[model samples]
Target: MVMIDMRDIQLDEDESEDQYEKLLRRAKTEDLTEISGIGCLYQCGVDRLGRPVIVFIGKWFPATKINLEKALLYVIHLMDPIVNGDYVIVYFHTLTSNNNYPSFTWLREVYNILPYKYKKHLKHFYVVHPTFWTKMMTWWFTTFMAPAIKEKVHNFPGIEYLYPDIPPQQLEIPAYITEYDMTINGIRYFEPDQSQNLLS
Candidate 1:
């Protein structure tokens, strides 16, 4: 089932400002943009497309009842392209390391709002939804959902899954799923409602 243990995962060493610039530069695109919920929109300097970018990380934006809904609507609005069969890259960052913070359920809600084609076109549902705080559910996803999703992506986009930063924090892991790995970058900070657009 292609299992990867969280305990075995290790984030790459910290990157310097120059290296960070290189990574960002490499990620730039005249046809693509990345939205992040990790911080303010100012950090996102590129807006080659119509809108800057719509990053949907639960941690970066305010999750208050009103704010969360606003964010969701904003996400839904921006996701229209994905809804229309256009390629849209959604890079999500969970606010908390635990399974609780910024629920993936919300993502499902976002999914439900999508038109059936887009919803059906979703080839992969890569996530870090593992058991407790250990695995990335790679095996569980493959054994159970992957096959179904594989067939679905034929009409739907093929599913591409990710466990990005597993065992989000420092923690030991079970042996069977011991291939989990992640590369941490930048100083972890918490700031809410302070981010805005940067492409203006």
Candidate 2:
């Protein structure tokens, strides 16, 4: 019988821990002014379940103009604190043209590097106004690379559907998203009073 060396396995584990520590250090120190200025990602408050809500406005993300590494670091920085506990993500796919979408390779790389702990604590991932491409890509990625998160992903046609899971009062939904929802749904799911209050 072949015997495995315990020393080699211990060394590998140590290296992995060191790499994660280095990543955390970079995430803390990185200057991400430009990325933050884009208004792509932010903590919007807590959901009805009291889980922290992280919102991602896909239309605002300038995938082509920004450095992917810095963008990744910024995402890590934003998520680091909250990932320690239960959290939910609201990704607005409205008005996300081809230019705004990042490369699949970049996404895959980000997914591969993220620790299991980060994935474990994410209770839900709500995609608002997801396009066909968005659905297809999400399916492909979840099916092959990240099966663990597949069940957590939910798609809603408009903002109103999100209210049942995440309270409308908690989220600072952008005017553009509301307008688009109105344009497509042809009925005001969000009342005028609610719109004014959220926009204010």
Instruction: Name the top lDDT candidate.
Output: 2
Per-candidate RMSD, Å: 19.9, 5.7
lDDT of 1 by residue, 71-153 (tens): 44444434444434423222343323443244556644544343445444443332322233322333443345444343322
Q: What TM-score goes with each of the models?
A: 0.34, 0.86
lDDT score for residue 167 of model 2: 78
C-alpha lDDT of all candidate models, in order: 0.32, 0.84
lDDT, candidate 2, at 192: 35
Alpha-carbon runs more than 4 Å astray in model 1 = 1-55, 64-66, 86-100, 103-108, 125-200
